[model samples]
Target: MSRTLVIGDIHGGLKALHQILERAEVTTNDKLVFLGDYIDGWSDSPRVIDFLIELDKTHDCFFIRGNHEEMVLRWLTAGDDNAEWRIHGGQSTVDAYQDLDIHTKDRHVGFLARLNDYYIDEQNRLYVHAGFTNQKGVYYEFFRGMFCWDRTLWETAMSLNPALSKDDLFYPKRLTLYKEIFIGHTPVTRISETVPVNKANVWNVDTGAAFKGRLSIMDVDTKAFWQSDPLHELYANEKGRN
Candidate 1:
């Protein structure tokens, strides 16, 4: 089987990301799937995006749109009018692009906007940036708020009701498709240690590398995971969040 490697939230930690990829021994034949949040939170947003773009040209790279990417896309499309983008770690992203030319800026914006919302393998492994709602048939609509921040839906589904039996767990009423959903948005302390909700269907790989956590990556088929130390301490100490 072709190796499918799923990378967690990068958040502009280029050094950490490079380390993890090196540790994972990623090759040309392996399929690399990035679980978004590629920009913001760190100091190398532009460099990270450029690296990914270049990697995409040579490797089988798949990227999903994370909440951070969505925020930037909103700013680029709407001209940062409401100032909502600034609140969600947008200032750093803006600063990253300040030195770039108009062509490069447009390229980055287009790249962010073109990211896929989700990817599902034939083996029933679902790859999404944040996650999908259990809201029946409309789950594929890519609802902005839900895609970027709907933890409640998944949480509610996992909570058992006394009225229903254990076997009668809440499943999406509209869709019968069941796959091991691999997601990254909410950061956990470990990469391999999954937040087991429904028989390990949902897995979170964001190890909070942009914050005080480590950068992580995992292989879907083998479940092999790798991580790198936090590289944001330098930025945090220097910028102090502006």
Candidate 2:
């Protein structure tokens, strides 16, 4: 069967990325949906983008934008930098591109620029780097940043009353916008989960590749998944999110 796999935040762990893809036995017939944060938190930020650019050439890929990717674009496009970004792993991404030629940098710029804020499939399944806040839906969201930074949507889902049905009048309207929602950005490692998390109809695939956790990918239909070894171990000698 042609599986649709939703991947979590990569956080520049190119080795883990490759290992996870292999473990999952990804085929060109499958649809790969990346939840973003392709860079930062590791030494292979530039190479990760390079590999992804090539991967898209042979397979169907959907790249969603994450908060870190947003910062990457800002730095590459307009030289925007802040202490927060640096301390949070942006510095690794910035340093990764330091020696690149303008032509190569421009190509990376195009790649990151073309990333989607959110993606919805024909099955009414939503894929995003972060959660959306608009009760109506993603299209009606006012702050574009919310697409890659909001946590309330996931928080709301987690706090949802299991006894309450979607038909209830008090159910969160935002959660009702899609049949199912998938997000990253906020790592689930913080909650002590190393696997994909499911709450209500929302699935969080970000198992925290940016930190000491593993990189994960899940089949949207089967909920079956494969994860790489702890990213910190993959790049033990280097410094990044690990």
Candidate 3:
């Protein structure tokens, strides 16, 4: 049966991306929901975007706008290159774009601009680069800094006492809106794990593809996963996400 594969942050690690797709045995029928950060880490940001653009033409792919994508969109459209963005792996993306043709650069900018902040699929499975703000239930409206930058949802989930049952009122209401909530942005490496980390109903799939860890892709419904080689090994000479 066809499956929905949710991918984690891909901070310009093109080689890792390719490897994970192959390792997962992704097919044209599979729906690839990417929790974005497609650019800005390794040296191949432009190449990575180009590959994704092509992938979209051939596969069912949904791209969620990430914090990095937001920064890049601002830089492309408004000439904003604040230190906050440039220092955090954004310079590599800028350098990568410098090599693209004018039309190709515009295409990339359009792709980034069209990315959604979050996607709730038919199964009510939420896919986002970062967790959404939980006022009470799910907030569909874009909450400026929350969608692509918030970690509170994940933090809360991580703090949940596994001893409590799902029926426990101690569980946050936000988690009840969906069957599963898949996110990226916060890498699992922070917890010393190089694989997807699950807490409560939240699954963080970013295994730090831009750093020392690997790129990850998981079957959302099945919880089966695939990972690429470590970023350092994938790009032995490049300084990755810092």
Choose the strongest candidate by lDDT: 2
Candidate 2 segments exceeding 4 Å error: none
Tens digits of per-residue lDDT, candidate 2, 8-110, equal 9998999999999999999999999999899989989999999999999999999999998899899999999998898889888878888999998999999
Q: List the residue pairs that clash in candidate 1.
A: none
Question: Cα RMSD (Å) per model?
Answer: 3.8, 0.9, 1.4
TM-scores for candidates 1 onward, in order? 0.83, 0.98, 0.95
- lDDT on C-alpha atoms for all candidate structures: 0.71, 0.92, 0.87
Once model 3 is optimally superposed onto the true structure by TM-score, how far is the C-alpha of residue 219 displaced, in angstroms? 0.8
30 Cα displacement, candidate 2 (Å): 0.2
Instruction: Write down the lDDT that model 3 would get.
Output: 0.87
lDDT of 1 at 89: 59
Candidate 2, residue 1: Cα displacement in angstroms equals 2.0
Q: Give the alpha carbon lDDT tens digit for every residue of 1-242 in model 3.
A: 79999999889999999999999999998999999898889998888899999999999999999999889888888898887677789988888888678899799888988898788888778888888776554565456668899999899899888888778877677777788889999988999998999998899999988888999999988899999989888789888876
Question: Superposing every Cα of model 2 onto the true structure, what RMSD results?
Answer: 0.9
Which one wins on TM-score?
A: 2
